[model samples]
Target: MPSTSQIRNDRTAVAAWTLSVSHPLMTLLVALWLLLFANLPFWRTVWQGVEGWDNGNPLFLLSLPLFALCWLYLLLSLLAWGRLTKPVLGAVLLVSAAASYFMHSYGIVIDYSMLTNVLQTDSGEAMELFSGRLVGWLLAVGVLPVLLLSRLQAPRRRWSRELRVKLVSMLLALACLVGIAMSQYQSYASLLRNHREVRLLLTPSNLLAAVHGYVRRELRAPQALQVIGGDAHRIAHVGAAIKPRLTILLVGETARAANFSLNGYARQTNPQLAKAGVISFSHVSSCGTATAVSVPCMFLEVGHDHYDESMARNREGLLDVLQRAGVKVLWRDNNSGCKGACDRVPSEDVSHLNVAALCGDGECHDEVLLSGLQDYLDRLTDDAVVVLHMKGSHGPAYFKRYPAAFARFAPVCRSSELDQCSTEAIVNAYDNSLVYTDHVLAQTVELLKRNGQRFDTAMLYVSDHGESLGEGGIYLHGLPYAMAPEEQTHIPMLLWLSPGMERHANLQAHCLEGLEDRALSHDNLFHSVLGLMAVQTAVYQPERDLFRQCLAPRQAFEGRAGASGAIN
Candidate 1:
């Protein structure tokens, strides 16, 4: 026998609970929690700011509420799409969770370049990234919330009314956010400037921005290819007899100059290259800090500032120009594809070759790039160029890059989980890969010298980009260029020229060696190649060419040229 007042109160309480359970506000709260929890790495970093308060200033506290409101704006705005909210938010959570796991585990950041690298990754690289850790994180943080959200029922409301409510709520949230930011502009600016990596690692936001940029740049139809150097042709000195020329452009992957002995590293990482008498350029930098950017940009006439992937993709590259000039060009790849740099030239993938000595289950040793290469070389005619794109020192499984015999450095990091290994172990593994690279380069030079009798030969080895080995708690490469550390940009470059090739270009070996310490970058690659092969084009800028100073004075030829037969 309950009293009337108590009975009425109980009914009211039940109605309130029912309203909350079925309301859009309740859904927004759930979405906010899902976003924050899914991005654990971001929250962890934010927690650091909490612990690092400046004398317990209350203004610093505003960041928390502002951040929550900002997320509310994002979530509610997304949810206003009616039934699509569940699917869209669920997908965002899953992707953000996966990105968080990798960023936390591998010390990587989510950026446009990283997104491009992810989308462009081959099945082999993708397979290597599969792990139980990823599965566990996805299930715990990504899938469970998605299932819950999918099961939850939406509030019954007219579409117009719902849209109006969503718009008002978003406006209120944004107003609060802007007010807070404006009030603490100095603090915010200082914090962001000092910790730039924070923006790149901020999950959900970083992921969204990266996805948007990728879609805008890569998914859309590209512009038509712009032909460059269409009037390219080679000219010969009258008295200097034409000799068959072979230049090997050895593109190394992830080799930093700081780790090479020839560049004054305390370790003897270049024992073999040192013995072979190759001149190592001590101050060379790459155009970009990632393979997807550097490989193609290195072969383009564009500099770092003006380098655009869209433009690079649409324009003919150095290889195309050389091929148009009637030079025989071949590209041999042991890593990933050439990223369209070799599309207009003859190219081969040696990673799939059947040489048991040089290949494993899915990938081949760099040595495989040399197998049957001499046959290809023998078949080429005069003024030839070959590019050997080696899979050198690509991480975090650096131990797999070299054979056991080349594992001179002991107690190396054997696991792909680099964080679990000690720093010494990681360096040992990375240095061992370099030692093997030294061996490979030495072997390449030996092979070139051996072919000197048939044709004047030269070899130029330059890494696409450098690697970061646990510097500033960063492992691997691909930080934004402005924020990139020296390790990611400063690369190793080595050159070897036979006496005959040197004389043909009117360059002395000692004179070229004297310029080893001069500052150079991937910007020099295009013009240098043209200079080496004697390809004269309207686009050839002598100021940009590394070998231009070494060449004898030229009386510019004014006529179309004919290809001389193979020099004998």
Candidate 2:
């Protein structure tokens, strides 16, 4: 029995609560909030990408926020159902917060390739990316919004009303989007066409689109493996008695050409390699800026331009072709797995060895790759190809890549938080890692020399991709190939052929040296390795072979030959 005024006050409070928590109203509010706060990175990119901002076009500028708002509202509406709105939107905000931190700080865009890199990254590499700043960003933009969202309670509505409201809201948002686009059709069309990457900079939309693409390509029903190089067979030298061949393909990670002294860098980063007389190719590019893409793409016969991750995953690549040709192939990894390149071949991973000197905390120095390697070579009784994937020059923990004894460059950045260190310190740590890689390569050469008496030996070293050390505000690699800085795409490649291998292949050291300035890329690797192994195959493209032009003549290797026997 309250008075009339008191009853009126209570009813007013209930009405206000219902209005605030109405599902459609809350969805619009959250969408607007995200448009203002969660999409700073997207707004920044748009502002910078537009030419002549001082005299900005009124319609174009008006369209920017209007389009973003309508787009976000429409996307959010799809998830604004009962009991699903808060949880799903909260997850998006958290993910968008993390994506924004990376996009703003590192100048990286969200795309399928970058998403593949993230999904393939091992625990060790992922841990290196963690920092205090990342946590702070999550707390501010991610956790706070999620907390605010958790407090909201959607007002329950009948099915008929809910459906009607959703339909009306979506139609209005769609109409607004259409209006904005039509108002500035020319400006909007030009901006989008000129800067396709801008679409990849939008916050949760880019992330969601990438996730959808990855799931469609990777998580779909498995396709049957496409077999290539079925007619592959090794051919022996005609005249001279052929000895067993041992070719080591050393794949380095994150090693750039600009830092290697052999490639004209001022520092003596390649002192050991230079003294070993390795032929360092000065001009070579990688297929991709990340290990996930580059490793698999380099192994494909299709090369980079025609490469497709799903197709590559379900196809026979270089190792499979080599194995089919009766050549014993093995892949030993110290970084991550071979990204499915070694799936069909025998492989080993030494990244978890517990050696006292070379390994600690579940990680090992690249030198651990040499352990038992010499023994394996000594036991070889047939032609074999071994790929040694080294953990070379990978950052932001570059200081940890080398042992203290090899830390020749003083004042190294010892922390994984790269932003905390000076550029000079970071370079010092990275250069020191290269020095250690040089040492490991030289030692590998010595091991091959020891086995030269029994087998013809050779080594080919090429990096999967390069790294970015605070170049143009880009700290790490994985930028899309078209927009990637030269520091991330230009990689180091070199060759070391034992005198016995030189004679067997009829390749002159002088001729190989003369071709150092020739432009090359990961595209040449497949055909070049086939040519180097003397494997005759229908898939082999002679024009793409690096050693094809250097070989003396076809007659030199056309002596009495037989089909190479498979080693079981």
Candidate 3:
């Protein structure tokens, strides 16, 4: 026979346990835990996510960790203060909601709309932001607890056994969570192997680079833009252009050409591009898995082989060569910076995922770039080179970025939540995004065609890197270099040049000639761009150049170079 107080305490514990279990709190907490934990390995990802990471965003870092503990504090309050009054809890909920809304809606560069923009899948930034698809969780974890505690009429309930059981369950859950986390940590290297793009956004090394770049703020052009080694203006003298101001290089973000319909992914993802008569390269490969490396590597003098070795020392590159050769260079980017490629030239970050573009709506669309593109074209100088970096296919929250209009395809062939949705649903969602990318390319080409009278126009489109949507259990890019897949390394490359434009540059002959659709890698970009622009720079690497008749044999099976571009 237990004493009266002990019996009361046991009953009390049981009652408390029931409240926790029955309420949506436990489940909501679990969801949040999984969401956060799945991403915990990359601290900055979730860190940069919550709006407080940036100095501009002005969210107190301490406040976030403190706010995270609020639920526990609230539970304690319930235990001590008994049931909170309806009006009081309601006000508290309202205030919290308002604050959350304000924080989420304002001053943040990312949101859920990009995820919804699946129809326009080429918008990679949307995909990255969309990876946060913890929907319904907001209501359950956020509003329900407050509502229930305040609304329930009873002041007391016996919860002894229930409490003990609940505590044990939570502990087990935490243990399982720990086990899972540990497994992820153990598999971290392997996981990164498949998701090679992780180096781009998450690695400490990358963070160090970003921090250093920020400290240096080296968008400062290290060299002056002057005509280099030639008549600079005449394309024919250098040997490619019949007229100046005709070439366009649209660098896509996070687009894996393999995923594009152009590469035979079984989805009509590239329908619009196909309809627009765009020439899709079947076996084009990106040199590096990350924009940080790939973008610069493609534009650098030393290719990926010596990029890391000599990037810091060697200052001159394609843009420098082009600028010195007198072609105008303007970068219209939606991703981060031009990663130092535009150091000497001009650049604009046109990310629609920015706070100003998506105020309160929480639905930043990738098409926003398209809206402002006309103005960009109009601003182009006669002999100008423009680079449009679209946010293509970046993601984890694959479903929320696209609007209802772009959702033409169905069954979502695959889902972002991996196991929750069918593989088809996930693929469908991803393909839908690819579809949007096709549209973007089409629109871009049309603009060039429409502006043919103003200048001879050509568009070169290539993705920064590829993506992994539930392939090998990964739903995003950022795979480690050592274990990146053919799917991840292989990407779509397209050249949409007007017949006149191609002929002017004398590249029309090779337009469809040698692009036999085999393996051509980003290593070829350095020289090809020079050939396209006819920029007469000594720094151009002719051996790796795509224009080389021998290399263009179309029988190239694989990129001879490895991740760092060694023979390995």
Candidate 4:
């Protein structure tokens, strides 16, 4: 009943609606906005770098449009493939929002190492990173854009036509980007050269680069285990009784040297350790800034500069060398697994130990590592080395690490949401865990002293990495090693040697005390352990050994020993 003109207009309106539903342009715009909003920190930093620009210059004005076009070209090229557009946008929105919040909040950058650290982290440690701010940003910046993207639809076309369109569009974008770069060659070069980290700070690009690197490393066929320390044997001390030697290597977790009283901390976090005659080594640096890297590296002969995590995983470490040289090696872990360090060694995970007094909800206190200690010791037929991997000061749940009795620091941060708590409360909670570590280490020393009559005994405690207690707006660890703050790398190393063990090796504690303030690191751990247990090996470098000053090397060379051999 309508006029022809009105009917034609109605059809036109319907066609536009169909185009809106089927076309990807709307989704592309939403994606572009989401990317910019989510990565505001990156833009803010870039602006700060260029804030003192020549505002009146025509070139500067031109740069703005060029910069905008650069991002547009990138986004169009990324989203050109039709079916992946919405899902890819959703993923980008979520990941970029999360990365932006953490990168801005903690002043961090994403690279392969940081990505690996995230992938290797335990659930408990990861939980500490969650907060209300994270949830708010995710919902506001991530979810909203994702919802909008989902509601929109892509236009259906022939497969060949779609592929051709995608190829042409991407090639056009590439050409435009190249033209812009050529026009502003000097400016682009200067910006990138001066601010190399800017590349790592890009939102979804950084994430993609990191993921690609991780996947490449993971997908590579694992290399064969390169054998080292082939000429390893235990050297017999002249005219000494054939008593068993027992050394406890206590691998502490996340306890920084800055909090230890013996290391000159204002608080007496190491009250028990101060009285236990343990040599607290200050100025000790870690091999890496996280457990996944530090734990295995500490057990290898490799130094921090030459350390490769994949190599460490494939090869045998100091424990294997000790076990090869007639020493009984046992690893008791209270934290996560030994991270492949004890894969071939006899290892026991004590997380499930049901001592309610020291454990709750499947998490056991460090002292639980001491449970059934004597019984485990009795099973060893020869000189032994046992590693006690402690769950010390691991954060967000610092209060959960220790029992109530050791909660000496008052008004602790009880909640896992650390950013919501006061700095004092967080420190108090973290310090309480340190006090508890001191107790556990002291108890370990006592256990060794009790067994001193049966076997010459000693103990060495070294943390895998340090923790950051709201310092520089950083909480928890695992910033890249090069950019890591001192709090994450400066760890505490303590040594307690019984008189019998001291006499057995002719080593002096005073000599070790003198080296306390000397700069040392996880590199010292491997060779030092080899020296401590008298495990003679070709891999042993006396120059790298911390105890080299205390004991003389073997007077004569000896043949190599296998896993089943014993020194007489």
Among all candidates shown, the one with the greatest lDDT = 2
The Cα local distance difference test for each model comes to 0.80, 0.86, 0.55, 0.80
Candidate 1 residue-wise lDDT at 357: 89
Candidate 4 lDDT over residue span 1-568, tens digit each = 9999999999887666543453345544654674567666566656654553553345744674455545554664565456666676677778888988777766677888789878877776677678777899889888987776676656678988866766675576567777777787777676677666677776777888898898988887988886668777777655447477899999999999999999999998988888889998899999998888899899988889888878657888888888788788999988878877888788998977899798876688999889998998877667899999999998768998898999898899888666678999999999999999999999999999888778889899999999888887677888778778899999999999989887766677788889989999999999988887878887899898888776523322221222234374
Model 1 per-residue lDDT tens digits across residues 1-568: 9999999999887655443233356446555765567555665665564455552757766576466547654654654467676567677668877887888777788988999888777776677667777788889888887776665556778888977877777777778777777887776666676677777776677877787898888687868899989878776544546477899999999999999999999999999988887888899999998889999999998877788988657889999989888889999999888987998899998889999887886898898888998888777667889999999998878988998899989899877667778899999999999999999998999889888888888999999999988876778888888888999999999998888888766666676788899999999999999888878788888888888765544422311222242112
Clashing pairs in 4: 22-155
Residue by residue across 302-377, what tens digits does model 3's lDDT show?
6656666136324556776677666778777765666667777877766644556431244454555556667766
Better of 2 and 3 by lDDT: 2
- Overall local distance difference test of candidate 3: 0.55
Of the candidates numbered 1 and 4, which has the greater lDDT value?
1
Query: What ranking emerges by lDDT with the best candidate at the front?
Result: 2, 1, 4, 3
Ranking by TM-score: 2, 1, 4, 3
Task: Give RMSD to native, each candidate.
Answer: 5.8, 3.9, 14.9, 4.9
lDDT of 2 by residue, 375-450 (tens): 7876778888999999999888999899989998989988876767899999999999999999999998998999
RMSD of 2: 3.9
State the weakest 10-residue window (summed lDDT) of model 3.
107-116
Best-fitting candidate, measured by TM-score?
2
- Candidate 1 vs 2: which has more TM-score: 2
